[model samples]
Target chain A: MTTGFGLNNLPYGVFSTPGTAPRVGVRFGDQVLDLAAALNDPVFASPSLNPFMAQGRARWTEVRARIPAALENGPLHPLTGVHLHMPFEVADYVDFYASEEHATNLGRMFRPDSAPLLPNWKHLPVGYHGRAGTVVPSGTGIVRPSGQRKPPNQRTPDHGPSRRLDVEVEVGFVVGSPSPLGQPIPTSAFADHVFGVCLVNDWSARDIQAWEYVPLGPFLGKSFATSISPWIVPLDALTEARVPTPPQDPAPLPYLTDAEPWGLDLSLTLSLNGHALSHPPYASMYWSPAQMLAHMTVNGASVRTGDLYASGTVSGPDASQRGSFIELTWGGENPLKLHDGSTRTFLEDGDEVTITATAPGTNGEAISFGEVKGRILPIQ
Target chain B: MTTGFGLNNLPYGVFSTPGTAPRVGVRFGDQVLDLAAALNDPVFASPSLNPFMAQGRARWTEVRARIPAALENGPLHPLTGVHLHMPFEVADYVDFYASEEHATNLGRMFRPDSAPLLPNWKHLPVGYHGRAGTVVPSGTGIVRPSGQRKPPNQRTPDHGPSRRLDVEVEVGFVVGSPSPLGQPIPTSAFADHVFGVCLVNDWSARDIQAWEYVPLGPFLGKSFATSISPWIVPLDALTEARVPTPPQDPAPLPYLTDAEPWGLDLSLTLSLNGHALSHPPYASMYWSPAQMLAHMTVNGASVRTGDLYASGTVSGPDASQRGSFIELTWGGENPLKLHDGSTRTFLEDGDEVTITATAPGTNGEAISFGEVKGRILPIQ
Candidate 1:
């Protein structure tokens, strides 16, 4: 009876015990094996995984393979006693609108008169740069952001706390090895450069976004806070989870076309308070993570070791499988009824949202990808 | 007579002589003064200004006041043999469309039927995040970015080198002091948090931008390479250059309203090859830097020590004072004749652009903001 932490899955994280500085640790059945003390490697002594991740693919493979034997003889601490931090120092964060369902849902609500999907949506993956400084670790309290929000009927905008605060369930890819300034990382080089995968909750203020996202993408609406799961599930751990993505129409350019399927067969669940609201299947995603990376760098934009890019809002075709409240509730026109007989159009104060995921492990076992949890607090 | 690098305006940078690692230095009259050797402080021994900048305003003030005496006794190296690196590691790079003239010009050309300025333009400082990893130091060659670009007449998009490469002459503000998460930095705290200003040339690919920038803001269109001058002119040195900005038609929000006017009166010159083109006046900008900083953080987004935010293309009322080539050429409808009697709609291969600025110093002397220069190279 493996609790999803068998030898097949060893996610990396930064943890600290009482009076001890934060350092690298590997998760094993309810316990964290300190990598620095177990392997006696100084690379794991740093707070961030950047130093070790920068050692490239070969080093990551060696360390991942070595962790199992080291766990047999090393001292371990229970997960409850350790405080986990941001696994890596984020370099640059780019969010891609790769979910066909989510993009179509948003386009229908935002632009009712026009076509559901934009002209360029099918041809290329649309992505934009996001605030890297505001990316916090999971369990960090989300402060309700205050900004300018104007409804359609309102003549002028009002400045106050955002009324429609929501969460976007996403899968974030982190870069380990960096590419040169003018070099484009091809789709074939995705696994070579991408270190691992983690869950992300891209908190958004819908009202602020609608009013301001015309010429510019998103600013204050999304920049306030973004939370990520503490543990990083290495790409090497998910070999059994590889699946084919939903077929793309009008095949992408040669630069973005991947010869092999790069989709992960992970299942994601979103919970509000303690009730499970939706399960957005990652297999239903339109674009693969490899294609997103290729499209991002095809223009010769370099990526750093800690660079993070997220698959924007994982949503399925069904209404119950929507990833964001905006899509699930149909842009606040329909309210979702909670398990406690309460209704929600969007998140309110003290609303806790947690997103968790799991994928197929070796020998028909399951591997957990940890969880990203956050509680909303009223404006300070 | 001082050549802009006077006693009153000693800007900070990082430079390295042959066989020596890069370290902190100050520009003083065509020579680089080593701060680590002069002050005998380890903070000045860092390769980037982030360490010293993180020490906050009081330390920065003390160091600025002590530089004159240190210059009198310290050994100086002529600037010719020194190679200047990126002064600081950019945390999050943001570009704000604060220029009324520039925004209106783009709006008029892009959306011909609608109102020039968006309804929300006057209410807030519209900005978006840019790739920090690709922000290169001045003199770095910019490779022509190739991406998916669909011209208006074409049925489908074509993937190739961008035909409409351009440059945006702007001023960049570097943040020295970081604000805590969820704590909004008021307009009055701008000078306390912002360390200095420098010249920035935000390279752009106009053709790719036109197709992809529908729902989302600019991405690869502007992410290839952003060039910044090596030297950072401290905010304290620009005291004499303060002026009143143009009046706002509608009063701004209380958070954006500054008690003291923070408008800078710097004169900027843009050159192509060796011909002087336009002179963009920073004083003509609609939004002040303080307001931009205040607006950016009002939503509880935290700022880091090395965050950089730029005033978008600083175009004045007249056509001759336009900052970006898109506006100067009216979106390629008009061509600008150079000194060689050659007309250009957009930047061609091997075209070099240099942007320089100057502000009033003490005793009627001029202080330089240095120059950000870059040459375009054909795609590899």
Candidate 2:
């Protein structure tokens, strides 16, 4: 819908600005737009703007609401475009298991008849703590794991480079403001901690995850590599794209229920190794982000900024639209044929997969969370 | 029994020597004994000492096994005369909610009939993400939190000082070397992540926790302030203190079942800042650290060095043995009458509290975790 240059699409990213004070910048086309310079000018200046006027590098949470209320809402919002770099400085990161589709799918495979959902799943947002120190921005090559794998003939797990590194398409959102000790933020305040959203491709080692997940959740299966896009789309901009909640079987508790339509109508697709023919649409999800956010706050736990709540393996109703080939083929019974004649239920090394999503809108311009890409490398 | 200053009375703490590097120290009377230096000298060492030395400070997991060997063989260990500090540098820290007595006691008032424990309760350890950034050493003062709070009778929360600051009596174990990713650490490998145990008093802001917990689990409610003693008591030292796990209604998964009696018969108690009266027996709890550890690995979660999982409250059947004033008073219903005639459930400004836990050894000398103390100051 946008006829002019899409300056409004200038998503901000955290970056180490050279020489100048630590601050923020907006990405327009291929260049970064600096936000600090405008703060000193008459057009943009205030307390919120002060977070962007740092000395070296600042986190998104530090200057989240500061882009001048007027700039965010008025005519100058789209007019200002100063060149700058990416705008992220992540301190800690956490991933949450929110989608019922992803949860149920994984659960069904574990316990078909009884996997309605582990009883505690409905009560709280069950999260296994992840490694924050290892979280890296997008384009970082994911490595295939050489771990204990079980072959049918062996008693002990075969130790070698895993041939089953897989990709999971997910959305990562940033936390803005920190909550108080012992206080749980209500649904209304979920956005307060949400700085923005980014594209996420959670790389997995399916073989490793299955073998190790008996007493704990994923370890090396997850630690191998998880990728996320560099750009951050603020929550304020996605107001128009929010969707209704999917169907639910068991009624959620007071904490999980909400009035707002929480899911995003994101047109999501994935391309394996740059083969344009492999991409598919993303839908058929039953849970919404609001439900996940609401469920998370029930424990009175405070979520930090830069924390990412992943939907796990997001898939559609059928084979082609299915997110992961694991569920798409029901674990390897039916293999998926790649464009280059490689048939697989999972990924192999040196393979690159890209996932991109865009929210639908009839407004001036439709906002999109760009592609999340990762290439697998053989582990020594 | 230990009649005089004897072998059984040794305590542990983190200390730094005037000329040597910082490392784990064993406490004897008022003087400090260094373990690393003694391990290097044969006059102060033994064959049992070789195992401890083999692990080097970089891999202190062997400390747990070596402690018992050193204790059993009787006094040839190098660390005896050699002065040591608290322990090695904590590489990472992860806290857990392991005690049902503590969980139920705390959950009873808030959740009434149905608690949050899932089917995995009897089998696996339930835990959440913890902050390693604030896992400070002993003698750190806990600051009263200044955060947004819902004032009494107000629908909207106001930014104010935390009113219900409390302390939790906890036990923390350190991991030695890192576990390979995606690998399930067998019970035999349990020693890998453990350097030793310490008395930890997890400070909590009950009022703030009550208000903010929802979508995310405890964040600021805990991260703002946490305190722990400096010693790393080898896991072997408490073998004599082993007890049986209490019975549960439902059976747990096989992974959660203990291979041996896992509970420790240590006498644990809390003081009002350090003044105390008689409390219940320490063997009154229903779970063990081993069960918690095994439960953590049940789902294939890999643990790293410096992770500190805790036994939530460590309360007994009686109110007197309660780990926290919050559990002792049921949130704030039971106010504590201090030695100075002060009565309240929460900590007051300048209020000091100390907690000490010990395992009575075969000899009269008690193997102790020593004291973890902190004073609460008004929010700055």
Candidate 3:
């Protein structure tokens, strides 16, 4: 389990037979391997999830419910690289802020003038419902968004494609048991409501957002192209990795505090241009994962599985420790001194932001959220 | 306009004649009239919007592009009473919290020890994309939600109906344009994105939220039932009421601050259990309307007319000015002492919550949001 070799990591996705057709299957090693073929022989596939069956609509979901312990020793371990698939899909996706450290840093950045700590902030987990249609699997090419961009000290307004692009590194969690509208789940039952975790890369445009956010918050700075890692690491596998507790002060409003201590000590890294300078561990956040999840449902907004919540630019204010350019350089005023004598206030065209994270004992083969590599394809 | 005739105050809905089916329109004065019946007339309608047949769609969007001065003697004056319906059929609804002040207050209530804002929160406006299906017109019944409510100091949770039921007094801004994905609107173009304003009551369940929000945010506290007033006050009518701009502390991120001063001073009130009480005006905000809209579209999120952006509970410290029970009583630990000698920690069944706002003018008829009221039904 420590090695993350548990069968619970069988990340399944809905796909098509190559042509605009909708199909479903599990992703293994380096291929959209067929789950149906491997199950041709009952004896070879009966142990865990069968091929044609694994590719079946409800297989991943049904298999996701069983404790990770049951599927750990299943016979399918030998069929690691086989091809299989079927038809299953998600109807909706609701992302929750499940990490405490991520939420803590986020709140501090936006609520600097206030207590930065909210009454409900500690008492409840929070999240926003995102567009599922754009919830593409990993490796999808992000389209360069064309929107209004304003520069500092400009008297006459200017418009153009988004030049100030940014990225958010996040671990995506999926729901297994559907939460009934109005039915509240407790902290102990968070696992029951969750199915697995994935990686998400929420792409953003910086320059366009500066002028508009006043009385109301953002309207377009976010909803654009969002990327997610392919694999779905189940909740059962993560239960063992849950940490001691959160460090929120003033205590919570009673409702937000949980019984069992929980936090994941996953190591995360973000590299720009290359894998050299940006990769950092995920442990620096002030809050915990359980706390973020708790805040999301605290509002009683019904949540569904397959939801992708991006921990928005997880960063601590320090060199070699900042998550994105926004924090590393404080919105470009303080340019990041780069290796080759070039200062980076923001990403250049050829820069690719790559994010990776892994639990200890997993060797260096980190469970990564592929990459959101887009050359600032020159504006048309 | 020195009054609070906000873009988020358009209160429109879809209703019908006792003898007919449901259609769309707004409740003006004493008349229950038809916009289609009015906009089609040469004196009332704009020629640019003729492309819409006035049935399926074509809200005030086209005409929304025209400046307010162009319509001084327009047809809106005589549509009183005529039996109004929801202004236009809403194709989509998006809500945002552009007022960083309110968002900041919430952050403080939760995390007392550290920063509560996210790094990306400054680069882009933070928001929770709301559910479109529940975007109902006024006069809708609010069903009391049932779920687990954990109290402070409890080791085990209690499963039952929600006890800490509350209402969020807010303003709803409606969009008038349909922005394509990845296409952002500049600050100057923010008005083109807005069509009007209305009042909204976001219902919340504090109990279920506390226990479940850990790994994710709210699922049951909200999304139960959100109420909106039924009459959209076009953006044209409220511009004259704009007052001095909002004051910002810690200065907003460059992308958020503006040199131009802007905001409305609309007189607003909350009638508890059908009785009126004084609430803070929309003027107490830290950010302005244009700033909020600018932040939203900056990230490339699509903006469609009829979208609703509800400013989080518009509250002040005084109980007479609290926007929600959460703040009025500070999470039930401190209950509000009401005028009727009744103390309110949360809304009770049969208790009606109405949020009304209007921009005062020389004529004194004041452009108002009318009434957004709902009686809590026992959760079955």
Candidate 4:
């Protein structure tokens, strides 16, 4: 299979050279094409990719078509020694629990005696708003969050560093076109609003989450830091990855039903301390990105450019395909033996967790979604 | 009592004349002092207050001191006929269930089989991130949201316009100075980081919320539209209104405790269709703003300049002082008697709901918060 940044994969990001300001660039092969310098326009010179993202899908397509022709004679910058930043200014972050396998695994582990899934699990896409201010770019250090956590037998919660910190491997969708308030963008219009996709490491504090996520949803437990890959693989580049979603047991409502194949077949791999932990398949997710977006905006919530939504956890049916440590080790009852002769139920200080993924491309090639990696640091 | 905009209460907002661009202005009495035009500088010329808000407390104090002196000879425009937009660009919105009365009311109404209060209700200021894209300014017509709602007897949720619409009376705290990631801001540093407070109307669709908010939390039920007053009342102006929060039964942990009395005794009155409904008291909240801020950041989640956190449904002890229609009307078991002899279990199209509030000012006078009013429009 063909690999590397081929013609079919020109992911956009923000990068800067030594002593230079950040500008929008496209990754092609091992080089970066500076869009602002090539176009000789200041529109793409912003520190973040929000301006370029706000240009909408038509403009985006035009730029995509124009960039390759402009690069034939334009100056190219070496990809080495360049600092990459967050591609866009995140407006809001929404996380959806759309993976049936992951949700069932969590339900079974957390509530052993009760049903695996909630009553409304099959009817709608379950999601909640997340902290957008703490969305950092890839390579940012993950600080172990200290908060109140209650043991099962404890009367009161104790404040300390989280002992059950974990990583949730998922794919995130980025919104490019915004929708006005009181308008619901139908499932068929997903391509018009969504710009691209990226890999996300939703670092979670399971101890804090278990104690605090009652009545309301997760807050500080999952808000400390959410890391995303710098490169954004545009939706147009993933045409070959489209696949039909699994049939719903109970038919979805008319608003959520899409006539097209909305699922993208991608393979995600998670590693910790240079040891392969799991391979969560994104293709097995029960809900598609179109369905998730439709459910989110059906109630008239406006969508803004730079808004982000992530698949909760891309776990598969097998134990080795579990996306989080809680499911893999069954709530830390059984620890995982790493290749470095270390056992871990949760993340430890100095442990580097890396997640990488790839999707099907044209000409029997694969489109790479680089990597989102972060090393855990002791609580400050 | 000081009823009008006094010397101490100089609230800031963004407004524009018919022929000019939007700029930051300070509301004083019946006029607005154009800060940008008055200072002969364009620092405050941005459409949103984010740029000026990021200047930190020292610069804010400097501007506050200099604005009044310069206003003596500066251009003063009448407040009437000016288009008021959202004061600041919301970075992140968090809604806190800090009011004991509201939480207990909700618990008693929804979960009659269990305790009225959740086990973790008093342990921490329970909160969740809310949609920031739909946070509108006051007077913006609220389009009735349509979503799927499952009745108790129905096996599947049915799609339609929300039958049970309500509003949550709240006071929102706006952050001006941001904190670094991994660093928790102490309660004493609240004044240094938070700029002001504004009135918020957290619109809710009770039926939709009840159906979907099980495993996660409120999503579409509360994301439709959240309206805030145009003028932001600075914390410095509320010095005389400060009061001690109600004592906690199980005393909070050290991280959630504060030495200062951070509660402001604001009287919030809710009206539907020109008839009084309830009078929720802000002083009845069990948690203080400082304590809430501390708890939110103790887990290493960074705060941004435009981040906003609202005191969820400020209900008092009396049933007449309930903040939401579900509580005041007791889950619609009893319909509210309107001024025109019409009855209402929930809001109807063309019905205007207005929330006005005031706090104690210097010398026994009252500082007005200025009303946050919105008329309900039919779902599009």
Candidate 5:
């Protein structure tokens, strides 16, 4: 169990003791090593990880390497005694539809009459900017979002709490380094810029999305509250998890192509009220993270430190590997049976959803990506 | 001419002299009154207007009232020698299709066989989030964005500079005060939350937009650069411009309705290379700014101090009042004759697009929203 948080998987996060202010810390098994106290540095004193995240890749690597040695002789605090917060301030949040299986499933379910995949889906990675202010840390209770929803039978929209709420199990990439405007970062340069990865539960209102998503993309449908894991597993720790992406039939453009494989073989598990629901394989994504980053910046949009972009619902080829409740329950037509003898179509008030993942470490052990858990609360 | 920047329009901005640090300033006739020096306070000393904007409506009103009296004896700097910067840090950038003409024209042009408006357009203010980090201030040169674009004849998308580049003349409302995440702000509270307004040039890549905007909305196509005016004209100054919004045909939901008129009667002019192209009437917008704000936050998205939401292309009923080149030239089918004897369907490399607007003042004078201008530079 201690090997799950081995030396190779020293993830950074912000934590605070009962009476102390928030400070940077690194997880070591069930304890947290206080990096600020260990180094006696003011750089890690900030409540958020933004100040340290802005130091770029060189500093991030240096600090990560130094953390293991510091923990051997430095102060340690029990994880139970400290409260973990949102690791870093999200500069901009972008959600990308990268999973071919998930996109195809959604298209087939939503638009049964038309072709499952859109014309441009094979050519480019489809993505949209999401609300950054509402991105909450793991364990934050998500309030049932109330908004305009148009049922299939109704001609007009009605104002009420969302009936079809869903969660997308995603792997979020945080940008540690900044790129200048009017410059495009190539697919090969992804490792030089991206900081780390974390699990994200992109809470969505399917009813609002169905009604409002027309000329524009998702807005209020997904902006209410997006929960992200507290621990950010650095890219350096996932060296063994790198796998090859699925082959493209038409082949991508030169800008979106990379000679090396960039996919990660992380196994993710989604649970509802302590019962395991489905397993979403991260390696099965059609579009690689590097390709997404390359396509995002190809048009000269600058990258800022703490900028977060998530791989849209990670689902594999099989039905058991579906990442979202919408897919598992087939848009509420099918209800999933849990271990507790309860059936769920969508998350109900007071029901808790937890997503956990693990990847193979260099030493043939499992490296966990802590948990991104959230309980849904009724409309206040 | 001087009445345009008279006592009625004291737009706030960030400016700096040759050797001084950036500070908040207000534009008077041909000079800038240093607000920090005028008030002798540290709150106005920040580089951006975010600090001042976060002070809320009461403080905003107090500062506006004292500016004129303090300017008579306060420190002044010549506008020629001062460098103006982004007035406020953009928290999030949302573009809304509030103009019926713009939406209908786009609908007809893009989907010739379909209805002029989408089914949900009448019931809701259609909007999507744009890249916030790439939002630049006025006078910033917009680099011709290069990306994957598919021509009508091409089977695959070709990676290159955008062939069809255009500008959307829009009015941006800046949120000064913020409401709770789960609570909806009513249209009646618009004055209490919105600090001011500015002009925005939503630079667009029509070809890229057409290709990528299907399942999801516009991404890289409209993300490269969005230029906003340096000065932010306070809403208090535009009291006389408040007019009744155009009649909503189907009638809005109760949450979207406003007891008082919230539309502004501002006249906007779009000029290319000094040749006037169109005059989009802001008062003709089908959905008011207040309604847009209400719809945006109704789904529980929290408003930040510097959040910017723009009224999408303010095209009126007639072709002469179009807001974008796409509408004026009818998607490159017809070219416009310029003063230099040049025919242009879309923006050229050296083309300079300037958007200026003036709203009715309380005492019959004109209140100007200082121009937002940008020159197009070829892809670097």
Candidate 6:
């Protein structure tokens, strides 16, 4: 119940002082323990976690076991005096539509005359590749994107700043180890390749997405900026968070069947300005991250170090649990009343959004994923 | 012309000899000129073209000007004795629907009741990101991808090897300089950021793409393997190939309007098992590569040095100019007759597909893109 960065949970990140170069560090109780000076390993001195993560899981486990003792005497810096950088260089980014509630809500809003769920939704974890180069660290300023958008009532499309700017709360999985080409990684090997978890804010432009996402999926609407939490919470720290997923009705194909339960009982909170808007339950998601990885590589596609895959917006069964503003505001028909005596249908210029998550840790502490925060900047 | 590797076309590539690591080299006739030894710059000692390409356009021009003179008296090796590797490290891969004929053919085949062309086809270029990690070099064996597919007549989806494996003949534009985050690269700056052109074989599984591309676009269906030509023909070498793009019915938005005609008069030939099948004309494409790049970053998506964007299947009005097997065979209703009297609707096991291209060079000779060849391996 205290601070989430306790002795039981040490999340990794890259930080630097005013004039110093960025290097790997671990968050431990308001201070960053420098891994390079403590471990005497040059890999930790890298600006990104890719070099150490590429050393594979065995080395990761060995180094992680020694982190507690190293923290006792390592060079420590105050968290407030340090600047956080992107933890890893993103290789490829893929976002999946895994939430049944979110998908159903979107389906009903987008296609009122048809069934809520697409036929391929349950058969596979629907996903598409995103702009990896645009993946930024937390606190990056998000400029309001300008593109073509045609509302339902408009005959000709108009080009300008997006009117329906929004955010999607989701969990991100980071790949540490790589797999070979022409080889598919099975669902059971998910933990061996996936290094850790982080929080993601997939900013979206619904008006641009509505006009363009036909036959080829979302592009510029979701690619402008995707923000990620600076710290990465390793899977070892989440041993107490594993839970069984909900029963699947039509049973997935054999390749997607999980040998062990891979669900994490994490809770996410989305906030705008200073008010908490929603708390989406990760357990309510229909598909597991392991199944998503398995499905991604089922066609012999390889994975590389620093690859990031995100679970689509986490939405629960209730209206208050929706992760995206589109669902929360019901396609701009309904507006959310804020504590500051203002109502909002979509994000406005200068509006700031923050997403945070926590999971159960050993010794009854909570493992925090920190927060991914961004402010919408006016068009330049 | 003689071989494509003429003096006028000094295409850059990565190659290695026995027991030697890969390094940057340039093709001058049948010899591989070692740039590291020729230019005395260590950047050419890199295994990929990313390092040299990141030095910006001014540095690229300076280095390119010295290449022809250096080739006269530089250290060289026979091309036959060296092994060609992936020319550059891919940062992000995007595929664009720029061809009018190919889009119309697919639209007619996929949605028979509707108009052949979508409404947004003329207004904006339709594109989607593809897996960058799975992009392999030329001659890499492509494994048959297995995924879920459902024919219209089938009640339920089935999981197995794809029955409609296909290829897309396209031209790829490689980015040589990095752009700032939240900044849009204009259509006029196409040559300033883009380095060169190459051939790409976008191997796709038609069945899987058809089933899953409803709301999210292509994923596993096209992620298995994308083969690119080993050599990259720099833009400076193709001065004579510039032409005006086909007329637009509705004038594009102001941002997409090009200051200069960015169209390239490149002719592509597709061959199956050494038998020439189709001759797709890149000149007939509706949208230019500059327009694709302008629209891609108009929403403030940054592009990296090694980022690659490919023109979608180039097709002409004639049936013999179709770029994909699905179009040539008319969705399997008609089979293509091969030179050996073998009728084929889709790629078979051990089938080798090669795509090559040529553009007008400074001299009367043509500039060749070499070739991107891949053989289909049986499902492992």
Report the alpha-carbon TM-score of model 2 versus the true structure: 0.58
Q: Is candidate 3 or candidate 4 better by lDDT?
A: 4
lDDT of 6 by residue, A242-281 (tens): 8877787689999989878888899999999968999999
Q: The CA-based lDDT of model 3 is what? A: 0.54
* Winner on lDDT (5 vs 6): 6
DockQ for every model comes to 0.89, 0.08, 0.14, 0.88, 0.86, 0.86
lDDT of 2 by residue, B89-199 (tens): 433345566667776676677667775443344434555555554555666656676544564587555445677787888777766555543354555455545556777
Docking class of 4: high
**Candidate 6: tens digits of C-alpha lDDT, residues B126-147:** 9999999999999999999999
How would you encode candidate 1's per-residue C-alpha lDDT over B1-380 as one tens digit per residue? 34899988999999999999999999998999999999999999899999999999999999999999999988688999899999999999999998999999999999999999999999888999999999999999999999988888999998999999999999999999999999999999998899999999999999988888878899999998999999999999999999877898788989889768889999999999967789999999999999999999999999999999999999999999999899999999999988888999999999999999999998888999889999999988
Indicate the docking level reached by candidate 1. Answer: high
The residue-by-residue lDDT of candidate 4 on A1-380, one tens digit each, is: 22647788889999999999999988887788888999887878998878888889998898888878877866678788689999999998999998999999888887889999998999999999999999999999989999999989998998899999999999999999999999998999999999999999999999899888889899989999999999999998999999987888788999999768889899999999877899999889999999999999999899998999998999999999989998889999999999878799999999999999999998888899989999999976
Q: What share of the true interface contacts does each candidate keep?
A: 0.87, 0.06, 0.25, 0.84, 0.80, 0.83
Q: Docking category for candidate 2?
A: incorrect
Using lDDT as the measure, the top candidate is 1
lDDT score for residue B238 of model 4: 89
lDDT of 2 by residue, A192-232 (tens): 56666777777777775566544334555665556777677
What candidate 2 gets wrong by more than 4 Å, as runs, is: A1-92, A96-129, A133-380, B1-6, B9-12, B17-24, B35-92, B113-119, B148-153, B277-282, B362-364
Instruction: For each of the candidates, give the backbone clash count.
Output: 0, 79, 160, 2, 0, 0
Report RMSD for candidate 4. Answer: 1.5
Q: Candidate 5 residues A9-107, lDDT tens each? A: 988899999999998999999999999889888988888877888888888888988887899887999888999999998988999999999999999
State each model's TM-score restricted to chain B.
0.99, 0.83, 0.79, 0.97, 0.99, 0.99
**Which pairs clash in model 1?**
none
- Evaluate model 4: give its lDDT: 0.90
Model 6 clashing-pair count: 0
- The CA lDDT at A291 in model 2 is 56
